[model samples]
Target: MGENSSPPDPVRSFSRLAVIVQLMMLAVVSAGWAISDGTAVAAAGTATAATAAVASVTTPPMGWASWNTFAAQINYNVIKAQTDAMVSSGMKDAGYQYVNIDEGWWQGTRDSAGNITVDTAEWPGGMKAIADYIHSKGLKAGIYTDAGRDGCGYYYPTGRPAAPGSGSEGHYDQDFLQFSRWGFDFVKVDWCGGNAEGLNSRNAYQAISDAITRASAQTGRPMVLSVCNWGNQSPWDWAPSMSTMWRTSGDIIYWGQSASMDRVLANFDSAQHPAAQSPGHYNDPDMLIVGMTGFSAAQNRTHMSLWALSGAPLLAGNKLTDMSADTKAILTNREVLAIDQDPLGGQGVKVAEDQTGRQVYSKVLSGTGRRAVLLLNRTTSAASITARWSDLGLTGSATVRNPWTGTDAGTFSGGYTTTVPAREAVLLTVTSGGGTSSPSPTPTPTPTASGTGAIRGVGSGRCLDVSGSSQANGAQAQIWDCNGQANQQWTSTASGELRVYGGKCLDVNNAGTADGTSVIIWDCNGQANQQWRLNSDGTITAVGANKCLDVPNNATANGTKLAIWSCNGGSNQRWTRS
Candidate 1:
């Protein structure tokens, strides 16, 4: 055979060897790519792997949302324009990053494979394309869905019939995956359909949260879940664990309008739930109506100031494309944003209110002795509002800086007083002297106990003890052995506060009316939940919810927890003074 074709075809064998090596290299690259993709997914999914995810936002997100302006008029084009406007108008540089499409972006039906689809007519380029455009502008994209079968704007006239699969009720996992696939960085889960479906607020929010976590795990994308239940269920009690921010009031209509004050006041009241505000989870008071025409420049400043001081999400709802100079200035104030973005994450509180409709709100800022104070004039005419340092837990003099004016308002000791125009606010940062200081002590509880002694649980024969003798707020009040400890000693105050553990008052957690809601000691906020009336019949009753303090299960165990329950006149509900 001619020596087997010259022993060997060296050239052909070399070519074959080269092809084999290339194939091996390609396989190795493919494996590496797969591993890299898997690692990215793992990191993104880790934020939501557990039922209760740690907060993703260290500060409330500053952004622009479509609901307050466009409502159901949102579409791919509108969002794209807003994204472009955000960049071109200097808002992006001012820290406004999110461009959220509020509602009406879904098709009326899911695909045969049970996948949610966008309204092709409205979003001709599709949500993914819109998200890509937003990302190109270095901004995040957000979308809206209802927790139930329909979103709040599901029936809004968007020139199309309402979508059948518009919400995330039975399709939470599917919708979450679809949103993640579309590159949505945020989701505002509204409650209209869910509330209509008779789902409990807590359970419904938790389910969607778990589904989002799973979807994030699968898609390798982190999504901010905003709970939009309109504060109907006191979401502050449970939404913190599940959502980045929860709406604490109904929609804010127009800025500085007479009727909008109700929404603002409702939010301010809801923000009083201090337990709900944290680094990752914020109490949303709804979108900012800052640039709207109805409000004056001063009023707009007030709106921005309050939102910032309260640690509420500052999602500007105005048209970014044509914002006026004054509006831009109000929205872009860096110093005010610093207070809202403070790491302390404390929600500003209504510390003082006067008969003239003047109110003072205060929040402790990040640094020691640094506080943000707001003097609000809610009246029809201009009035002088005062902020007492002691009311804000500050004793010594503080250098007051007007954040809006960018000027020092001089140092003040006892308090600061300023004239705020009607329906306006003065925002100030009070920086205390660097010396070591302490707040004026809380007023000692006056002994007003009619019975003047230990409150003994009649059936258990144990004393009501502050769990662990902890003086911290929200410490559970429970029955314990009669140790004659300070925690077990109780004195009923004239103001109806069950003063125990020094200044802490016996409180019904969240003013819960339900059976088995924990009884804890909280700061006396003069809320009805902290008020109690000692009945002549030897039973103690919560003043507002009208529930009696009863030991859970009527058990006589030493550590049985005390809760507020219906007044059935049970022996366990009775309290006797020793």
Candidate 2:
């Protein structure tokens, strides 16, 4: 990856294969590559092309902004320092491609010629030098502007505003042209449509979008258009056609700074839908507020995971040079970031709500066999949520690998359940349970035992005992009498761990926890010995015992004894449909 001496448009020379290979290389560096065939390669190629087509101009914007630690009090010196830091920090090699000047860059008045100019006192060498310096670093420059007629600043931060005869106009096309002339590679146009004095606000956004597209083509520099109208408008539905990414949530104000955790969670919750967003057009959940106002490592990890899972841009609002090691670790976690940058580009959905009101977001990764499940606990109390194997379409058992700990939670059946502390998140990658499906076998005889007596319940309280044991986790179980015992109670946890009401999952008892270890419910902790597979034929088999439920020699008699024996797929190992 060396600089080109040729005069070719370095950006235009980026070919499909080159970009895909680069992305594949990055995936190999960050995420492990799955064994992919032509179909998967084609799918990845298409996704990469879409991403490159819309995102090629400004792939990973890596410039400094004033919003993170310094809000509006930023001057040109700070911008220069950030630009210098981007080069010195080796971030350029990591693909931070843009140095954007957020807000505060504008002054009240234009030049005597009535054209917008950089503030001389603030920007001494003018914007052209800054742009040159950025380009010299193999990166691009970005700037911000408002869409309204009049910028709210008293000095008119963005000139005289778009008022009816203020010598200034609020035309998106004109503004876009002006920005293009400034050599900007990215534009974050905001303050449009939501204001009270704006004219035809809804149409104004669309107008700006049209103007951006037209201007980018005119400049021949392909500027990345970031629509910043907030999530008030469903950007997912409308903004995709306009820009590369639109803000899908209200402005992110930093951890423990602006709003409460509840507000943040609610904002992201409402924005999840229309799971069709791919590489180019993305649903932005606003900027990263991590590492700002002194956020902890754990909090930042939570922020990164949730944002990545939502397919939001990884734009860091915090000052990069002033970051801590812990903060860097959280931000640089490749495993968590891959979930967000996956080729599928699908937004994570709220799978379940916890008792403390936390949420679990499940995002299926690029491959059909993998998933990134984020357990986010937003409340002040420790909360736990369960993802069932059946609910996630997983079969039998899976290896739940926690990304943060870099450790495997062992192969588990049902689903993987983890407890997250308040205001924290747990991100895991789950390899599919191998028992997703079983091979079809020869049909066996259906049981038909004529009995005048009713079937007795086995589990606690009112359980149905269709004359036999219904001893499987996913098995279609019925009600029966309590018998004041572990066999009477059934535990139906969503994570695929089923136990008798007040007992653990029926164990082979020690796991000999012994043969003839009557199926007794025990604590529903995840252990291979306790897990039972509910076969399609209504037979229950213990994973460790390697035995299936034997209906005592396939007797077609009422109240046949249920016992576990080595798996032979015999008639005795099957049960009749209830």
Candidate 3:
């Protein structure tokens, strides 16, 4: 990724003259456009991009995943013990029901029929028996797989006996049907092989969803699909349509160790897409690391508060068979759980950051004028953070109750201030203020200025090229070896269009407004789809469609088609203007 340059090609010296000539022309056109219309288009699409959520799970899911504690080192006895522990530990009644058996439960070996087969020795009664046992205990069963032919274990070897071809690549329908036949209530698909093979996350997940639908119809059982691609495709934008939840970041814990507050906060920051979340579809910040090796009770509270405020899934990633009272208390807090499971299903947003590491987060609850607030202290010392009434959409005095302590914190007008210990967060339930319904709003991404340079894909190291150098209205946008051609030269106009070929603007075909919508060259029209925001995160977000310009299949091959997708912070979506 350094310098983002290729070694000198044989024709590089000869092409410079032509590239400079074309570059000058593009600059002239851009200057004229800026002079004529930049001011007029400045306010276009100024409204919030979107506010609707997809229909999926009614609320963020509450469950347990094995990867956090046991990982691939699982067997029938291990899972059965965890399932038994779930009930005995009171987590089941406390709303932690799904007992997920993450990776390592299966070997790569499939039968002649290509059906997924588990380790029979480890699973005496087979996978269905374990699922039945979980169901018998009034808990749902969850399983894991990869999108590619080989699972994650093959690459990371995080757990016992890593195997290859454990993914459901060529057998999407067959494998999902098999899982449905086996009675799994939930499936969390990993992206190890998908990333390794450069698969288009949106297309891959969509195919898996379709397969699951077919399986569900055949089995008469609905299954929850959890997309765990580590935010590579900006899953939030499109995942809700196909999944109950989608992981918005990488693993929270470093595995086999105590979860760190820094990692927890990092994950929280990555999952903040309030506009993309809706009832039944939630952002997943990986599994909860509440009782992990290194977390203090206060640290656990901070972690829990962030996830609850975000309305993210509350999947415990610790060993359930054994628990300390403090761990149990932090995991089973009813009030915090209620906020996460609120029927309103609104994800929280940062209302204020008074200082560098002092942050205030607020989420609207189901009841009128009710809001859940988290005042987080990330500094080295305890800091006094204030939650303002106006920020929480409240007027005058408001009653603040301590949910963790289950006591009233009294009413105050305008704002409430409290001391939060270093690396800790204070969670409160505020109500009964002259409350309005508006949620705290954050500014949309600041647009990256159109510059005269090559827009090179970070992952592919290729330049955005217009296919065939066609001047037609429907010329396809693609990537090719950076040749400094007129097609590869783009002027990010002040008006927000990535313009090339003098007048044709980079556009979403037909203004399709969906993930994987292909990019094309079209006559410039001040349309929303043609407008884009160059983000600091290295993505070009389409202003109208609210999707990122993406390379199909994460491909580096010449002629790879360019499209728009949910912005997952993937390198394929990252572009360097040089």
Candidate 4:
């Protein structure tokens, strides 16, 4: 009879079952989306558009960062002293403007409202005061944070942990606002506990980027975002829109007393990504280890030269106040700086390599046809490295100037061969026509062409080539061996432009009507100087000035520069399309 009574309570049983279903649904929603611990623990959405109010940094920032030298032991007094040293040491005048405080600047906990507070024990006067002092000296201030739930490093002096929930994970907006209010000009966001949280790197960084944009609007301060994820997740693929610079390698350790050679080589490999380099967005190979004790004088030179040629941000990690003359010389070379600061912003490439541990890296300077070459000998003993003019896109003699010595190493023709010590590099600027020019005496057969072929000089039989096969503006058009390279290929465009390399037009330098003006390859601006007409008599005439394209001195030798001369119907002026 009792079992039968249970059947009578069927309606009640259904009601209980409905209540259980509702509870399960509520639990699911709570677990999926809930703000916990004053941080956004939920997954991030797509990145928002960068704010227009904030201008993108057009060059790699030159500054001094704390983590490399001082690490977590940094304090207000140390930063202030460094700022003062920067000025007295002439570093500030040399363009090292930002004074940065790395990790351990924050208290172990955020306030009730999730706002981060400076550790009063280390920063007795607070961070704003420090920023103010730095600004008074005409320098900017930078601060660091982590993207994880807990920071990466601990404060060894205080014996305190990187406070839990102190990172930008769930509190990006709050922390960004706090950083802005503190007058920070730069923010370095690291990925410490981020991966442990199971967060996607792209989403996590985009969240911080959005917060930076929002905070910048509220505070009206332009903050340079430095992505310091140690090059994980290939930040170069996506960080340009969000940051001014990014780390492409791990922390450069002081291997011995100077920069570690292995780390330097790693950075060189990272710099091979050409598309990562641009105006304002730079490929950071970490700080310059020039003044550290572990490296020799030769290693220091190699370190600085590679950083400059690679377009890396030159953040001096050494103690500026106690630097030696040699260290200062390595760090403050204006000629080296010129290559790093060139307007072209093109990272140098490894143009030549050999099994003997010798390599050549080359970069084209903006506005000048000069090429900066670094001959590196990575072997344990001295090695001879040869840089053929052909490999460097030059055909004639070039004056080799050593920027480090501020003196010319004399003009070299054909090729410049030098012996470099082990673990050292030779930095030279190869400029066309600065050295003695020797015309080739060998007679080349007259080249024939029909369509889209090399424009062979009838007098020299050498093909018209873009110096160094360079697609850059102002690259000289010169006579070289007809090798069927795209830089030597020419085709008449429908717009009356003699185009090469797909779209660059054959241009008369500066549109000058005067004789002896060099010919160059420039963007198709539809300008008169870029317009040319191939006449029936196998002569290419400048459409604007009506001058004939002639080889200098009617030289039938390779490496002869091409120019616009008076149309005299000479063989040097005769050019076959093939």
Tell me, by lDDT, which candidate is best.
3
Which regions of candidate 2 fall more than 4 Å away from where they truly are?
Answer: 1-64, 87-95, 112-114, 152-171, 192-194, 254-260, 354-358, 433-578
lDDT of 1 at 429: 94
Error of 3 at 345 (Å): 1.1
TM-scores for candidates 1 onward, in order = 0.68, 0.61, 0.70, 0.65
TM-score rank order = 3, 1, 4, 2
Q: Show the colliding residue pairs in model 3.
A: 56-280, 57-280, 233-568, 234-567, 234-568, 258-294, 450-492
lDDT of 3 by residue, 506-577 (tens): 888988888989999876554677777777778888877878889977899999999999989999998987
Error of 3 at 512 (Å): 44
| Deviation of model 3 at 438, angstroms | 6.6
- RMSD of each candidate relative to the true structure: 20.6, 19.6, 16.2, 26.4
lDDT values, one for every candidate: 0.70, 0.52, 0.74, 0.69
Over 137-159, each residue of candidate 2 has an lDDT whose tens digit, in order, gives 67778877666654434322232
Cα lDDT over the full model 2: 0.52
lDDT by residue (1-578, candidate 4, tens digit) is 00000001012222222223222332332343344642212212111136232324555778887766776667788898999988988778777888988776774476778777777877877889899999999999999888877666531223335466546777888888888998998888877667456556668887887888898889999788888776555666567656777776456763223456755754555444444455556777787778886788778889989888887888888887788888888877889888888765566765555433577667766543377888987667999988766555555788888999999989888778899988789998888664222222323222321135578888888898988877678889999999976678675532245656433568898888889999998755546787666665677778677788889888977778899999999999988866
1 or 4, greater by TM-score: 1
Residue 261 displacement in candidate 4 (angstroms) = 1.2
Residues 470-512 of candidate 1: C-alpha lDDT, one tens digit per residue: 7678888899888865577664532355655323568889888
